[model samples]
Target: MPSSFCYKVLVCFLLTYSVQYMGFGRVELNAQEGYIFENPYQKTEKQTDVTSFTIYFNQKSSQIPKSDEVRLQSVADFLNQNRNYEIYIEAHAVDGKNYKEDILISEKRSLEVERFLLIHFVEEGQIRRLFYGNSKSPNRTKAHAALNRRVEIRLQQKN
Candidate 1:
């Protein structure tokens, strides 16, 4: 009888382990019932839209250079043509030990870009701003820092 109980326990353990590690199924929560189990390998539709632009900045400066103004103008033209899209602006700074100052500078960069977009007649509600202070940089080298100090503009279709 004891041997039979041990065999049952071992079988249960193996089944549970196989279901989890082998991705046999996944447990999900629902509004009606407390829980439900579904197939782990179910297929779902994925829609991807890759459209964005990057505007570079000089070291410790949030000013938009004259050369890059044309790029911003192009972006403004695109926005003017596509009224159904919204812009997402992300400003990043080089990795400096001064976290507070870096954050302020990044914020200023984003604001400057947003101001330019506004001046070009992009709707205020259509532009969103985000700032990252040296936190997202992959490398700490001077070149990489220069690359990191830039603003990214992403255009997304309005839902």
Candidate 2:
């Protein structure tokens, strides 16, 4: 059995959630100091969380840097555990205005990443490679070229 105040809080919470979900209006709690209004609807623990590593590459180089070498083990472990998910390796390089070189380097970068996963015993069937090279970039400035020189790894569920 719940107390009257607890029951009232539950009712208020449900009403607030329902109204917010339907785009009606937001409920202002006007909470006081020392009182933390935590969201009860959200998960208290992370859901099936897998480590996300930011794998970066050197300028015009496909070799994985020493800083990111250690993180690849965690990625391999996760992929091995989640056989239903496929990992995507998207490789990119700095824009040198030479499409041929850019494409070649990017393809090499993706293969390098795939090689690491393969060495760790992750199934080859679970990997997808996409090489964008210099065709795609966040910016055209030399200062931001480092941002483009990298590989992005993503996981997707198998159909």
Candidate 3:
């Protein structure tokens, strides 16, 4: 019985030692460095004052295309770093025959952007959405009309 108890104790010690040395679910300690845990999935915080990002939409479509999807990552990264910042999302739509339809489309676009940001862990209270519809467009050309269909994200630091 004593030999069996000694074996169990040795097994427990080995297990603890292996866990500590292999860095499995254990934090490493150092005199100068204090405590450190290596996590590959950890997101590195960025320091930046950049406060604006624009996401353009295709003609007559509220969905964000794959090409422009990457732009949201920068916004997410910025927001992640600046917890005290509030986001202002302004969505605009191109002028169509029906004014109300334009407004609805703009609102949908803004909501989509807001949803994306929220999914990236941004707080709901930090987001303010505004839809400009077709009223704010100054350009009459077809090429520029495409430019009007966009969602602009502006970040402001909380006081």
Candidate 4:
């Protein structure tokens, strides 16, 4: 074989192999946006089974009622019957607080509900969704924010 021909063949093979072996470039994940493909935060439907219940805070009550023992008991009964269901506790405050504090307040309210459920027999894993809505709007009256300081539970459909 001619040396030049051999050289050409070797060069072609090298170029082709290198191209196949090398990827385009480094890929970085950032928090600015959510990704579906490589999502570490994604919850499987099995893990996300949810149930929701709402509490209406009465503005005039002046004092928030002890976490609704009756309602929580009902939730406990439901959970006992339907072990497949998971509860999501959400807390919402009437939109009367300063904007900066709404998220914090809402989250606290949600956590409080979670605490009450925990005091009962609900498993922590069963409750996957937790959120707070500080009165963005008067969907529930400010007077009722305490009552509105409620928890919602949802059932995650099996995937």
Q: Top model by lDDT, which number?
A: 1
Better of 1 and 4 by TM-score: 1
TM-score of each: 0.64, 0.65, 0.64, 0.50
In model 4, state the lDDT of residue 120: 76
Error of 1 at 99 (Å): 1.2
Off by over 4 Å in 1: 1-50, 95-97
For 1-159, candidate 2 gives per-residue lDDT tens digits of 469889999999999998879885667868543222234552223223344434667777888875455566667898899999888888888745588888999999999999999999999999999998787777778888888888887788888
TM-score of 2: 0.65
The CA root-mean-square deviation of candidate 1, after full C-alpha superposition on the true structure, stands at 14.7
* Total clashing pairs in model 2: 0
Clashing pairs in 3: none
Q: How does candidate 3 fare on TM-score?
A: 0.64
lDDT score, residue 92, model 3? 89
| Candidate 4 TM-score, C-alpha based | 0.50
CA lDDT scores, all candidates in order = 0.78, 0.77, 0.77, 0.56
Tell me the lDDT of candidate 1.
Answer: 0.78
lDDT: the better of candidates 1 and 2: 1
- List residue ranges in candidate 2 displaced over 4 A: 1-53, 95-97
What is the C-alpha lDDT profile of model 1 across 44-71, one tens digit per residue?
A: 2221222576777888899987645666
Report residue 5 deviation for candidate 3 (angstroms). 89
